[model samples]
Target: MTTIKGELLEGETETGMAAAAQGGQYGAAAERASEAKRALRLAVASSMVSKVCSIGLQAVSIPLFARVLDTDDFSAMMVYFGVTAWLSLVAIGIWPTVTSIAADDRRRGQLAGVLTVSWVGLSAIFASLIVLVLVLRPVLEQSGINLFSARHYSLFTAALVCYAMLTVLSVGEAVNQGQHRQHVNNLITAAGSILNVVFILLVTYFRPPGEEHVDVTLLFVASQAGFILIRVVNMIGVVVRAGWPHAFPGKAFARELARNSWSLLQAQLAVVFLQQGAVLLCYETDMPRDAALLALLFRANLLLHSFVYMINQPLWPIIHRNMLAGDWQWVIRIYRKLATCYVAYGLLAIIGAAFVGGAAVSLWTAGEYPISNKLATLCAVYFALLVTSAASTPVLMGAKAFVSLGNIGMAEFLAAGVLCTILYFADAVSFPHVVEALIAANAMTALWMMPTQAIVRLSRGSLDAQH
Candidate 1:
């Protein structure tokens, strides 16, 4: 009887220990969840404020530019902005890769290496930009692209150089973000927006009210300088406070970053197509009228998309942190909430835009650009898909599923381009048809990407737990 009792007691003790271990894990997970939730809230709130300021400034500047600059100068300025946007992404996958690796390094108390890597990567990218500018400027000027107009080519080149300088320095923001402080970047951006407004106001104040006027070069240079100063200060603060380590990271770490960046570049290029492809399609199809409408519609959609992007910007680091923790359940939970919120917001924005968007556009443009309901709706659907894909980005990026993203994105763009081409040749092309093709193409991408990621992540998490 005593032997049996002793055996029973041993069994009970083992059960109790197991329960305690499980409970300890649950407690730790709950704590992590709480921390993540708080971080996201703060990030979103800051991003919201930043985005509001940006959107407001943009609203102010657009009409201000339209009113002040002549049609040619205004068009040239818009093209200049577009070119700079592409230039800003010249670092491409480097940003995300650095951000993710930086997060991992921080968790392991080894951020110094990643920080050095980021600077090295930025330096290389800056050199490449300089080379490209020198090599491409002559070719582009000879080609007579609208952006390189003889009148403003020199100014544009100077402005681009300034912009490139600032862009390289902006890597600071990526590193800070990985440290779970995206608000630093948001603050920098908000300040830059305010400065841009000031520059615009100055331009408006000094305007000649005719064809000859203050070109965008001064404004661009001023804004870029302001951004650079703010970012440099922030970078210094971050590095100094983090206590820069003396140890140098090995080449393997750099190689790892390079490999990841290459994969990410593919994905980033795919995104560029989705964002800019509509305007190109309109131009190619010879639908100038539709092109104008598409431009307006895209701008309107972009404003709404900006809000989504703002939220996701901060959420990205949080996702990376949880991903590093091997907390798949937490990631999924957050993802579901995020995806649902995005879809709901997209649906509501589409519905709201369908109602007030036309009137709003009319008022904003002072009745210059009138949007039709059909065109507005199609644009909304396309951007909704775009933003949804964007929402899934941090997750795929966290998983380092860059190759899959590239493949799907490539296929999506190709399909859209082919379908649009067929319609154009068949003489059935319209802005609406082009948008519809985009919708179909992106839908395939989203359908494949999101589900597959979830399954793979869940499986991986399960295996991890079992081990």
Candidate 2:
């Protein structure tokens, strides 16, 4: 071996050169790894702050709207949004797939093209849903709950449009998640929630006085509409800045997205029904107020669930990466941690609802809609069930168990509807009774999730062994 002039001893030239080259590569890799970790830290921190603020704004929003509108109007408004949520689920087309694909696919520009098609195509679907809603108004009204009249039909239509438009932004956020830039999505969504506060204030100020019971509905819809517009624009700017310069591929990719997105649609609809079906069923009863209260109560429980979900959101990419690496131990450990954390959170939720929930409800409604302890307990139970079931989702998603998960979701939806049916024929038909039925139904679904998750883990391990 010969040495280069100024570098190494004469006999060790090849070894020294090889060692130096190896060291250089190692140093570069370590630097890149360090940078990647720093970025993840920042993303997580930014997401936490944004989620906290979003949760805060959203927490106050339900009760504040209750204060601004009369009981009947408030219920109607909640029902409108609740119904629109179901509609929104129909348009979720391929956004999540777009997120996962974005991580490894270097051609981010292709996704921009896909986003355009998804936006336009999904908008058409959403538009049709609005028409269907209009057409079905008579059907729903005939069912005994006259929730939305022609007076607010346009507002509901407009809100649905805003919601459809928002999916474009959601897909973009998914891209950011895949790209490890979650802070971008989290901050923008946080801004939208903050703007909601402004919209609420405007609705409060612009209301025509005594008719706040009804006219405030316009304000509620308007503020949400505005928030949707702003956030959509925010995401548009993010993509443009990313310079997605790839031209649109042929129709094949778009067709693929459309094909798979239908399953996503099913999954989303199942979730909405699982949570809101009870409330929707309540509308079919003489006590529309109970349906509305369940809706509001559902939203309130979202505040508690928000904590677990926002934290879980950041872990998706991390978990996805680990799963790709065949890190079974890490996956198992994290899943266990998630289950334990939710259990603790669930207990915290029950305590808060048991001790302070009634006082908080009274304060919010000013004795107008006094909540019973039983109702609060059932809501707490429902929430605990939500956490328990949802704990398995991220892991399933990491394992690419969507088809199974989607099937489970559909089964749960049918099961939940059955529970509502029982409520419909039950001897006692009060709100608490309705909620109790829902809690029982939701718990059964939650129980199924653990076994499914275990199956996924076992199947994965066996396959790995065979390979």
Candidate 3:
């Protein structure tokens, strides 16, 4: 650990230590500050490697998808992902809530208590979800909501079931994050990306022009098997490292987790609505091409954001730990630096979007799909607004300001929903119009409101610490 601190600190800015000293009452907790930095460095490094691997895999897989798959197939893929993203809502923020609780518990040597509660809660939720999916299957089928045609519905169902299992099992990931072992989770992610590339390669080789050389269902099964393998492996590692929960936690602790999860659920639901819901909206409005285009754009934006989030995500646990130690001053200083980086990245992304987004899309899709500069610029602006709000997300989450975050998310969701409804009634629900509504909604919440709320929460936390 000392060697790691020396190596990481050698490359780290002097600002953190300097800021710690300047933070007035850093207390005895100040001594552990270097350890936090070490953990954060590992998290960032692992995330970077994982993301870079994903980018490389995508560089190979996306063009194959664009060229090899029919429009229906491609659209089906997007819908599959969009629907799975919605599955996140089922957790109702339990995952992050558990992660936050686990971080606090680790400091107090009560990690087993939190883990046991999370396992019981998530397992029950998963079982309920299975029942829900089975019950809804017939209803949705009979409802005639044919996004992917009758033939592909079975494949879609299978894939979604696999993803549902993956989501529930992701408590393992939350466990690792709280323990500062994000590298293991990250490596598992890289392995998943590798599996994705292999799946794409199989598709490319077997699903050649005018002939189906491989059973598509078999490929799907293979992919799901790979996902289950990696996730289960990660889960086993987490249990070995953290140990099984010694005992089920008290009902009060469970209830508190539920309360926090409910608050965060609102935010998570809004996020899903803004992102995946938009793609589904395009499809429902009878705009298949628009749906495909928007999905592609969102995919591009997400790829860029993932790199930024690699740095941002490590902050959740680190800040939560510091906040528990009453190191509010250090938290505030770190946030200021993070906010600066967000602004800089947002500007550069906008510039890049204006100058090269369309060209980049065309190149990425091997000229299969071309986008306009206007659309590209709008996408960039939307992404900038979204990322800006995210600047304070970790800080707010760490501060346990769930209600404030939830309210902003609810506002943003309502704004987007109302505006989309208005556009639909006005017979003006075009691609650009939907994107514009999203931008407006995000501008209202993310651009200023979220950051302001974060500052307020930080101030309150600082005051409490001093008292």
Candidate 4:
């Protein structure tokens, strides 16, 4: 009896020691994790500051352009900008899809082939889109009544090509971010914005005045050329720092990328449709002046949204890496913190915009056409939704909740369509009314979809992690 009791006591002692050692290791890991989170938070804050500065530059320039240029010129330039944005959607192809794949590949030292294939695939898509745009030029020329002249259209096409190339080059930056090179990505984007501003100033100075002045198309082309150069330089730097892969894309790797990239591509396409499609829809249905006004409101909202995105974008890879490691608890905690921060930031932005945006608009436009109270309200609500929705996006994406993301897109589309249709048929739709409808649709979607999808995915992911 004494021998047996002594043996049992020894076993308990050994188990206790093992547990204590494990506890010490866990405590160390937690400390490290906390430190990493602090570092990431600082990075996110820095990125947001940069985004604000970039957005401010854009906002300041708009009023200057508005002052120097006529409404018709501005309207035509908007169409040109819209077309370029649309073309970029097509040209981007599968590069964004490659981000997670490239990250995973890099972990295994297999990223070269994947990166090569992504580049080649995107380049091919860009070429195809250029050809299609050329073929559709006649159709585009008849798209709006305030269409640009042949010279402008040709210049716009050149801008689109340059924009497409820059977008492709930006994939390298994305890959860099995925590999935890956030500082590099931020620096490159900031530098590009700076260069773009310089080019814009030079173009504005040289351009003719009044109706013949302000060649929007040429300015866009020059800006894009500068942007593309910057991105190419940045991409080269990433390659130099990260070191290129040893092999080109293999057949099996290409197949894997295609399969893995489909969901990301679909998600991206859905987003493009949700955001840009709203502007396009407004342009198609509303008068040119109304479309321009709504565009201005959208741009104002986008400034806040862009800030939210900068806050969230750098955190995506971190969330993805944790999820890939099957760390559901950490995922939940991080997501909760991020969601709270986003909501807080969004609320602050809304309040600030409500109070200060009008004054800023007046100052910028020199009271040329003041932003109305209704428009200000619409901008605030729209920005709130944009920020919150963007904040919740990483959660959905991390959980592979592509279906939920798609449904959110569909809901927004249906809501926007119904609202616009109703407003149109009722003939009750002024610019403010249209803007309100857009904000309502966005808020409705975010309110209904984000929480529901997040909860479901979090629950499922948690269970899966346990298994």
Candidate 5:
């Protein structure tokens, strides 16, 4: 009986040891998950703060510019800025391709090679285009309304080129982000924002308010130069920290990058057309005060959108990395958390804008232009739609469903563009009516696209797959 009891007791002891080991494993996993959540939350908070400050600075500057310059001057500046904005899409082609490619563990080196070559190619193209446009300025001026002088147009074109270079550097930032280098990326962005603020302050002080006091054209040129210098410095820092190779592209790597980039390029182009195309359409339509009104509304809308962008920006690389690794469960969790935060913040913003935007506008302009109820309401609605769109965009991006997103954007643009074009030519709707059309188009696109993309992502089991 003693021998039998000894063997039985030994078996029980072994069983207890196994159970303890299992419990420890579970505890470690839970702790790891908790840490990931905390890190993501911190990243999101940092992004939001940075974007808010940047957008707020721009918002403040607009009123100052309006006060210092006359309506015609402001409108002319808007046209010049619009041209540069459209060209930016062309100049920054294929850089975002680096983001998704770098996310793949097997392809990071090749992705880096592709990024190097693509950047050179795109930069050359942008430079050539800028030169061509500059050379043809006389013909361009004579053929149209010529909102700005040759000098101003040239400066705008230069700004666009510089912005393109910034876009290339942004790819490095994206790569760092994919590698979970959030802190480094945040530091660079924060520094860039500080530099921009300093530049803006200097511009304001040196330029001062008056028709004869400052050269608006020169101000923009100097600002663009400053922007480009800051971006170059930031890019150098990212490359140094990431140990990215400064080498030419490999043949296989270049091919792979091109393949991945096609979809992204399509999506980006569609977005460019959808957003900047509106400005072009407004210009073409010839509705009275259409450019000025659109610029004002767009500036306000962009500020709100920037806030949403800040919240979502950091998530992009994280999502890309996880999705590439087939970690769907984590992706879903992150998406849900981000969506909840965005919705809450969006609600607060809507309320604040509805209650105070009018008063703020009036004070900023010193009653030079009273905020109409219609304008205020339109701005609020636009911002609300932007928030909803922001909340859904990340899920779509993570699913590699950019093709569908591009299609949806194209459809929205076509619908709104057609309606606006008809109204402008027919003299049916006024400037406000065009704004209403745009708002309705954007909202409609979000309503259809967001749900569809979410369902597709869930159905593919892409959100829950493990790496």
Candidate 6:
């Protein structure tokens, strides 16, 4: 026993000095690595809970809104909502870039300034739109659309306010995302819905008792104002938390942000055209049935896709941090993992939507709106394919592979335009034609850029890690 002890002591002595120090260093590193992984797991769990909660909130909120608003009013409000949302992409294309820049140390202080510039720019555009809407008020009111009646002019103006408010809110969202505090955005969104409900009830209650039926236009505008109020409060909180750096727009800073954001905005425009342009096109072609179909499809898919975007909100900051840290290989590996997870989650959602969404939708609409399983199936398929881009594109964005992605986007836009034009000119256009266009466009883009180039690069391994 003594000899064994002696030998052990001798072995310890051999490994004790420099070897022991090296061993201790490795142990500390292992501990840090484990802690990081654990923290990541917690962040993911938090994100999932936030997403589920937000989606559940929307599910409940929509039905309640439907119950309150008459069909024509609800449809008109949605048109206002959808069109404003789709167009705001044009003005706030810099949000993703804001997030990317704010994720890093060098540009962290610049978020405030960038947001100021973006808000000013976007607000001006929205004001121009409001002026144009007012100028064309005569034409619109004569058009016989529910939103266009001279009586509903207040509602149209309110819708414009909603547009500007929502766009400005993106600045705060981008800040949260940059700091990996995306759950706060969800919390604010949930709060906004509550505020919306309260505002509607209050407006109804305060209306003169003789006029029990409050103007649908008033309800629409009030609810939008509620959203804006909540967003303003949240923005103040975020800025306070950030210690309110006076990021007054410096010339160079604005220019740099604009440069980085240009490609991002281009990407946004293309995506908006691909995903939400259906309704506009349908309306333009004078197909109200097709427009209605697109609206329902878009609303449902919007909720479903929210899960992906919610998860992605926390992911980009992590990627950006690593990119700045020069961890290229890690970024690729992370991208592949996230892409797989996103696609898998999307597939599960597709299956659920395809099999059951039609019946659920029919039940919700009381058979007044009987959507088919086949259409659900096709839309779900399109959604699943499209989600692959969420993780992929962010990786490209982090890698600053903007030029490559731009080329890819241009090709996709061209393909979509060609397909959609053909469909538009075709006799007796149907939802299937729209579905075909979506699937074809999504397939072309999703397959080529990240799934092909980025995934292959990851397989080959990261250049940074290799070097």
Top candidate, metric TM-score? 3
Model 2: lDDT of residue 330:
56
- lDDT tens digits by residue: candidate 6, 328-441: 655666676887888797788778877897897776554545787777788788777777677786666666666566667667777887888888787645666887887898
* Alpha-carbon deviation at 25 in model 1, angstroms: 2.4
Model 4 CA lDDT for position 464? 92
Q: What is the lDDT of residue 18 in candidate 2?
A: 88
Error of 1 at 426 (Å): 5.3
What value does the lDDT take at residue 28 in candidate 3? 60
lDDT of 5: 0.62
Candidate 4 ranges with C-alpha deviation above 4 Å: 1-39, 91-96, 135-152, 208-212, 242-244, 248-270, 463-467
- Write the residue-wise lDDT of candidate 5 on 290-381 in tens digits: 66666666666666676666556556656665555455666677667766776776677667767787786676555655676556766677
Cα lDDT tens digits for candidate 1, 328-422: 87777767777787878778878876877677766666565567665666677777776665657667666767676767667776777777778
In candidate 5, the residue pairs with backbone N, CA or C atoms under 3 Å apart (3 or more residues apart, or in different chains) clash, namely 325-467, 328-463, 328-464
For model 4, the run of ten residues with the poorest summed lDDT? 88-97
Give stretches of model 3 more than 4 Å off. 1-27, 105-110, 131-138, 207-226
Please list the Cα RMSD from the true structure of every candidate, rounded to 1 decimal place. 3.6, 5.1, 8.4, 3.9, 5.0, 6.4
> Which model, 4 or 5, shows the larger TM-score?
4
Model 2 spans > 4 angstroms off:
1-44, 106-109, 128-145, 208-214, 242-245, 249-259, 458-467
> Native-vs-model 3 lDDT?
0.76
Residue-level lDDT of model 2, residues 1-467, one tens digit each, is 33365455654778888899878866765564464456557776787777787766755666677777776566667777775566556555565666666664455657676666656676777678767877787665455435555555665566666666675456667777777777777787677777887777677767676654436556666557545866678667756855654676577776656665666666776768855666666664656678777776877776677666665665666666656655565567667777788888887878888887787776655556778665677688778777776678777766655666666677667776777677567646667876776676666764676557755774676479448
Q: Could you estimate the TM-score for every candidate?
A: 0.85, 0.83, 0.88, 0.84, 0.82, 0.81
Residue 229 lDDT (model 4): 78
As a whole number from 0 to 100, the lDDT of residue 305 in candidate 5 is 71
Lowest summed lDDT window (length 10), candidate 5:
87-96
Instruction: Evaluate residue 228 in candidate 2 and report its C-alpha lDDT on the 0 to 100 scale.
Output: 80
